[model samples]
Target chain A: MNIQNPEIENNVFDVRGLNLWYGNDQALKNINMQIEKNKITAIIGPSGCGKSTFIKTLNRMIENVPIVRTTGEILYHGNDIFDKSMRVEELRTKVGMVFQKPNPFPKSIFENVVYGPKIHGIKDKKLLMEIAEASLKSAALWDEVKDRLNDNAYGLSGGQQQRLCIARCIAVQPDVILMDEPTSALDPIATLKVEELMDSLKQEYTIAIVTHSMQQAARISDKTAFFLMGDLIEYDKTEAIFSNPRDKRTEDYITGRFG
Target chain B: MSAAKLEFLREGREDTMLETDQTHAFERYKVKIDSGRIERRVRLNNGLKHLFSLSTVFALVVLAILLYRIGVQSAGWLDLQFLTSNLSRFADKAGIYGAILGTVYLMLIVVPVTLILGVSTAIYLEEYAAKGRIQRFIKVNISNLASVPSVIFGLLGLAVFGRMLNLGSSILAGGLTMSLLVLPTVVVASQEAIKAVPGFLREASYGMGADKWTTIRKVVLPVALPGILTGSILAMSRAIGETAPLVVLGIPTLILKIPDSVMDDFTALPIQIYYWTLDTVLTPEYANLAAATIVVLLAVLFILNSVAIIIRNKFQKRF
Candidate 1:
């Protein structure tokens, strides 16, 4: 369900003047964007652009890298994420992430799904089972994998593994889910399934996806942000960005003139 | 109709692409593979394979010869008495009972202390230490320690464990010395196993709000366990066969009584074999006893390696 924000109310993430550097190389420049709650936002750009970097910044996952320097204010529910008082583990729980590759733990599908809940002190088997079933259903994979819940996750197809990762993310009951090129590794049919999953997922979790496919942004995202050379060039409704971009660079990129 | 027929006949021979004169000699048929070149390559490959086979056969022949020699000497001597009775001044009554018990006691001390200390050091270096010069320095030294002669570790043990701590030549001192000799191997191996865990797994755990220690315990350790166990067993195997460290620690080669406790004096298999081999001048039967002990020591190493292989195969995963 696309968020029909007649008047956008809550800003799930309010990023302002965000700049990040890797060692001596600058990766992201002054960026400002307001990510709306319960909406699917797609970050699109060419190779070497800061789209992935920007998505990582929202959850502070980028800080996992050494020699990374960031200066900015990212307010999640109006609290500065970079503040020293903020606990990374707590932040990550609220802002769950699905990576580009399907990285399910080398474990049973049931275990993979309940990993988050189990770690969060959910010891009841019945509760964990319920959460796992609900998560798999939400990711649109329950019918296909229900009978084989105890099988190793690696035994699943690549598409199913990616869906399992999505199931894993939602099992944590996260408020915002950040996906970094989640379907770049999947085939077209699998890609379509995940795209459909996103439409439903955004009803619960605020999603910000990074993708190289402009058509995907248009197809799935309600809000689209274009990044180029570490700078955020344009941000608007997906329809407008694809139909009538205001900036010359945005037009050039959308029209396939230059990337 | 006659004019159309003439035009068709003329068109068939035109450059519209199938003229006989346009065809080159090389285009007449497909090229053939040079059999001579292939033959030379095959010959070279076969020659090298033969050499490799010979090298392998040489190693197997040597091993077979040694096993046969040991088996011959062990005839009549490797009986139930040898396994159960203690060392004796006489040949027929001499046994490895004391050495076997001592070895078991040594392992009891070595296994827990080495695993706890080595695995913790590995975890600290891999999970907690910054990826910089300090970590590299400690890592390099640990690896270097593994390569240093076991005798050097024995000297260290003699100076520190045997003298400074004043445990004397007791089983405790000998076990500690051997542990020092093998702890580096365990640490290096555990580090490699821990490092082999996927980075994304840790990220997933952390994203689930698990703390670093919790993540390591739940994710890293489980994934790396087979490797850690294999390494530990292999290191312990090395300790089991060690004679130099025991010698430096001065564990007597003639303890006829079983070591009932860690503080008690002990006689290990290698030390018994060493004394037996040296006392062959007294009676040739000592040589046979030494050979019998070798067979038993070989069995211990074999069991350890077998366990290692079993764990590795059981835990081997596609990822």
Candidate 2:
């Protein structure tokens, strides 16, 4: 059964009966959800609950696992992402990802931010610099790294590096960004910075984040999805899910009764 | 301490232990040190350190003695005239000009061929190939080929490049044979270098919508280049100094003309040293000529290795 928000007919993704497996072990089971456009969707679950796997499926990056097998459909902007006619590169151009660890390339900060634009054939140095400036400002990292654009990215602190990764994603001009526990490795202050950055990012990009922290979901996300044992048990407005969950499992989980 | 104190320390603040029991606990808790065991361990550690240093010194001394002997033998014989002149029947007029040129020409072929073939093979195995029985079989055979005798490679090269291809003992044939001899080492080293590239970098590149080739070219190759270069240089050095493979390939020991092209007949430094050392019985000065040739070969290898180290350092700092 797919859950669609009747009031908001505009959806960015419509997943229908999606199931995934790694070799013989099932990782995601029959998930159906409609992600609305330009909204912050937070997927929170215990470890190994397949929230990460579900987000990776949106861009088809899970295919890199070599043993991953999926059945059903994921429609991105009305195109079946698994269709043979749909190019993976084209799909990924419209979608970007941020990993749990702050993975800035070993290149200079300017180079790291411009990697995507350069690969997409943007050769004009002036244009690349403009894009870099705009993306860094959007990611809220311009003030910290503006003076040292040529320094190696590894020189940045952990919080700044993660922001740089977000800036890197923004330079691609993607419509959606998938984050796999992007703030799990940061301290409380750094986590707060990223959360604030995410609040402003939703104005331009649709975001789907998988987080381990329930409080982070309540604080920043508009839609909340609680997954348990490879199944998406609840998906609704954050207030509804937090205050008046319809499912007993969702109520128990949010109350810290059992995972 | 006393049994009660010991229990208190072990389990943290036993409820029944009062402050009055602490008055006599100091005497009971007096420590006993094992000075004899400590002394024995310290002595053994120092003795082993001295023994290891002595072994290192012994090796260096032997190397120094050998270098001194070669230097003494080649001092008067090695000169600019000796380096410029060609081979002759008399020991006083002999030179290794042809052999030096031949060795340099041989490297021109081996370096490019081995690098292209070895790195390509390694990339195919590490990145493109599927993991299964067929890939495993190919990997096992490549490693096994590394341990096979270099002379065996010479025989294969002789049959394929010399007889079947009709290249004969030309520098082309000898260079191809030497490349085959060192191909396994290059392949193994390149594979290790490519395998050492971290997975996260590849993931990050792909996440940006870059395809496999772009990711490999931009991320993987730059990271693996230093290791691959170092390995290839060491392999080339081995090829430059090898005698058994050239011997099996029927390379000429003495030639009057320097090889201007790969198709021309040639003689290498190791082959010249072998022939001169064999002729030492008839002319004792031929021994000095062989020693002089050995010194030249060592100098060439040293220069090649120094370049490799410099390049490796330059690339290693980028990451």
Candidate 3:
């Protein structure tokens, strides 16, 4: 479904007629949506509604699955990401992602943060230190972990590790950040910290977060898309969608009639 | 009662009977739990613990006895004079200096060649190769190769490195034969270590802009280093103690001069022990010489394994 907003002049990602299948079972069916630049776009749905699969497709991360196949157009900055001329590494460099779990590398905190920059060939020790500092400050984890940058990342608490992961992604300096339930594994207070981080992060990078919590979508998102069984049921401003949903299923889902 | 109400009462009675039957079944289950079966299970668990301990003790006793026997035989004969002297026709004048040098030189070749070939094959199979019939076939064959008789590998090595390459039973041929013998073990172990690396780590790496080669070198290999090193060193130790492959490769048992290079003729510790044990029928002192050689070989293996354990621990702590 194409629910374009007239005010959104610059779209970061425009997914059109996207159909994805794992072997024979279809996971996403003809999905069409636009993610606006410099905004938090939340995808809300029940489990198994293809929210995670959809976001992974934007950066072609879903191709890691050997049997997964997709037929459609996912345009990033007006270029088709699936085209042969577009390199996956280059696309991923511009579009970074954070997973559901706090998957920090088994390395020192500084090493973890600098991994992305290092992969992109930043070899100067002083330059990498600066990048690590900036990214950690942006992720809001520098204050807690500044003294222990050389300590292993696994030594941190779950919340701190997740922030470290975000800092690692930020070090790459990507234009878009896709979060697959970034706060599902966190407590309410940690979740609040992440929500606040997202609010500030949007000023620097466009974000597409796949979350199971409608309250979170309402609390933090500028635009929200509701997916149901691989279909885009409704797409609109978060306030409008929460207050007066156009689709009956979206209203039913939000009101707890059914998932 | 009315007719409909009478029918409903009849259905309720049947439902009550079914419920009573289920209650009886539940009671039987509870009865079974309270029976002596749990006591029997507890007794079995304790008995099995003791039984496993006994098996461990038995193996330890056997090993201790073997070590004591070898130690007793090597006494006075394992002096520094025996270590520094060259091989001789008389048993009292014989030394393992040449054998020691040969074994060290052989390992210098085997260690590097085995690691390079084994780790590369593992990385190619686990990361780069497509998962299909060919990949499965290669994997199965590699595993099978691990179990193939070491003598077969020696024959293959003799045919390829010895005659075909015109190396002619030099230290290179013997070292190459031992490397072939242990290569499958290293490859299989490396593959398992690489495979055990969590998928999420790779996903996290790719989520950044890291390509496959970068991800493997930085993320996967470091995490798998300990397991890879432990497996490889254990396989190398096995190669050091192995005699059949070297024997098949026709490595000498009594070289007088120390091996200076891979192209020079050499005699390893195992080959010396093998010849000495056989010569004990004519000269009974050769048995003590064999025992002394065993002591030295064991020390070498012990040192190699200890170093590997230290390296494994260092890497394991980082992750």
lDDT of 3 at A62: 98
lDDT of 1 at B101: 88
> Which lDDT tens digits does candidate 2 get at residues A1-259?
4586675447889898999999999999999988888899999888899999999999988999999999989888778899999988888888999999988888899999999999899999999999999999999999999999999999998989899999999999999999999998999999999999999999999999999888999999999999988899999999999999999988888888876
Backbone clashes in model 1, listed as residue pairs:
none
TM-score of each: 0.91, 0.90, 0.94
Q: What order do you get sorting by DockQ, best first?
A: 3, 2, 1
- lDDT, model 2, position A131: 98
lDDT per residue as tens, model 1, B120-170: 999999999989998999999999989999888899999998899999999
- 1 or 3, which is superior by DockQ? 3
Off by over 4 Å in 3: A6-9, B1-23, B32-50, B309-319
Full ranking by TM-score: 3, 1, 2
| TM-score on 0 to 1 scale for chain A of candidate 1 | 0.96
TM-score of 3: 0.94
Give the 10-residue window scoring lowest on summed lDDT in candidate 3 chain A: A1-10
